[model samples]
Target: MTTSQRWISTAINHALLLGAIELEQTDRGTRPHRLPAAARAQWPDPQLLMVEGQPSGMRLAFRTTATAIELETIPTKRIYVGMPPRPDGVYDLLIDGQLARQGSVSGGDSLTINMSTGSATHERGAPGVLSFEGLPAGDKTIEIWLPHDETTELVDLRTNAPVEPIGTNGAPVWLHHGSSISHGSNATHPTGTWPAVAATAAGVSLINLGFGGSAIVDPFVARTIRDARADLISIKLGINVVNTDAMRLRAFGPAVHGFLDTIREGHKTTPILLMSPIYCPIHEDTPGPTAPDFVDGKLSFKASGDPAEIAMGKLTLNVIRDTLSKIVTQRAATDSNIHYLDGRDLYGEVDSAALPLPDRLHPDGDTHRLMGERFAALAFAPGGALAH
Candidate 1:
């Protein structure tokens, strides 16, 4: 079919195409695939009968008893071939070194297990984790086409081993998006991102789409959130764009609106909240006229941002929040489920009283704990804004 025809066909049949994909290897030697950081933003964890490391990019071994499996996950979008202009996206799955499943994906997609019941379908939930179920109860090798751009790092694998099950209630689905801070910057483990902590507190499943150095408002992200399955959702916006000085004025406004518009497309009435950037003096009100300095020879940026920019009709935090508040407030008038929660409320002057983020930018693990607790109370608690 021609390109136009293919696009039309895909758009028409997209909804009908849904399910988890598999890439099994006949050879057991390559039991687990290593997915590295260099890879793009989304992908699956390597399947395995065993695992090692923090589980972020850990390795997994395949066991025999496993029959069929399904992987419901998010993709990193970056693929590599040991090269430069990094391959645009994810790698295809190969079974026993042969193409088994295509690696292509959309903004938000779900992978269902094709296997039958009694088998095990492991859910890594990692930006990329091999999803699986069903097995011969023996040893099997699952291979994932590593993105050429990323340095290989294997995450985790779920097995049919005799272990304690999580429970009957199943985990709550917590959808989260934020800057590198929420991406586990200085955190200890994948399960340690601040959002992860909050998920633990709420006893929910986590869908973490916190990209490092790329948290600017993107329509793709909002689209992802809209289609993503979640019992709750939170968006940590600002900060990254501010620090990188990504936007000046003209672009920021439409970006935010586009972001919101895209999200509302799929999740027409899902409970959504908008959060401003965390406290960072460097990007405060000062304008770009400010210069960079160094402490101990390390470069440090000054806010040098101008509140006047917003005053004079430029877009600033005061602008972003004001814009978001007005929009959400207005949206609330017609859309009761829509809401706005100030980032400051999460760690405003009062909450920051005893817990100051180490870098004055990102929250530390301990601070993450505090933030999660506070969020649980203010948003997730009974009668909380989110609950409502």
Candidate 2:
């Protein structure tokens, strides 16, 4: 313990890290990892590197008698050039099991990204502090959910009283992987993201592997899932593949099969749900290469690939849905635990018309709530696909 700073080691008692495979200690602080270091070494894409480094579902859970808590962190906030400044990533405080307060660091290093040019520029900033005070005078479980989209380095934790680490809370683990939509894009806060909402509704621990622009059925991702300890698993596939023009129908089927095969190797009977793309009108029948549309300075996506390519089995949302259904049916014949939930069932044409995706690719806050509520009822409710 450093008496001068009065900050205790997070590695000591009272800090329980969930949904992370490893923590890489750095000079500034510690960076959490969902994927193992070996897997990260295999895929060196700058985008993948950025996404994985952003701790989405990770949290600092502990049992403390302290009335006040403070944490110092260096967060890498993202900035999109020529767009409205994004809100700072939120740090939610859950006392006992309910939300007690929400806080955010005002100043942090910035990573300026130009989605149009696929370029990024980094700027250094000083670490900021988050404080929560005036707690009831008793032992309580405090969970600090990190920012979903920003890369954060946890530097120090200070409290008025000694704290102890929280053990497993006996919640079932839900390991989910998908695109930026699942990574909390456009979601108002970290806890408001669809997966976070669904995890809370269903009472499960979340291990979110949602990587923006990077959920393209990669084998390393499959292997990561294969090794994770999860009670339920889900993969929301297809959008990234289509948007990147990554694969056609032929490679798509094989890639999906291979990904599933790898996961099944470790979790032979664990309920695994495969979700197709939601109702994306621009990419419904047309192929992508989705291009960003800056409509009046706001970003939206439009399908840039030719609709005529469907004859050649180029991927589209509709076709991907059909393929996923067939794959689930065939797999379920041999493995009853395998299931399929059409992504449209979560967010469809009706929902789109009423609450269209502001970006034409990602759901807005309300839609995320709607999708989360619908998904929780559909997949985690009794007799639902993920019901354990």
lDDT per model, in order? 0.49, 0.87
Model 2 pairs whose backbones collide: 14-164, 14-165
* Residue-level lDDT for 19 in candidate 2: 69
Q: Give the clash count for each candidate.
A: 65, 2
TM-score of candidate 1 against the unseen true structure: 0.58
- After TM-score superposition, the amount by which residue 243's alpha carbon in candidate 2 deviates from its true location, in angstroms, is 0.9
Tens-place lDDT per residue, model 2, 1-388, is 2344354445622237776767888877877876788889998887888888888878888888777788889998889887788878898899887988999997878999997788999998899999887778798898888888888888888887777876558889899999999988888777888999999899898999999999999999999999988999999999999999999999999899999999999999999999998898999999999887888877778999998999998999999999999999998889999999999999999988999988889999898888889999999999998986
* Residue lDDT tens for model 1, 75-183: 3322222223323234344333234554432332122332223233333233344443333344444333332222222222333442121221355566677776665
Best by TM-score: 2
**TM-score versus the correct structure, for each prediction:** 0.58, 0.95
Q: How close to the true structure is residue 107 of candidate 1, measured as C-alpha lDDT?
A: 31
Model 1 Cα shift for residue 278 (angstroms):
2.6
Report the lDDT of model 2 for residue 161: 77
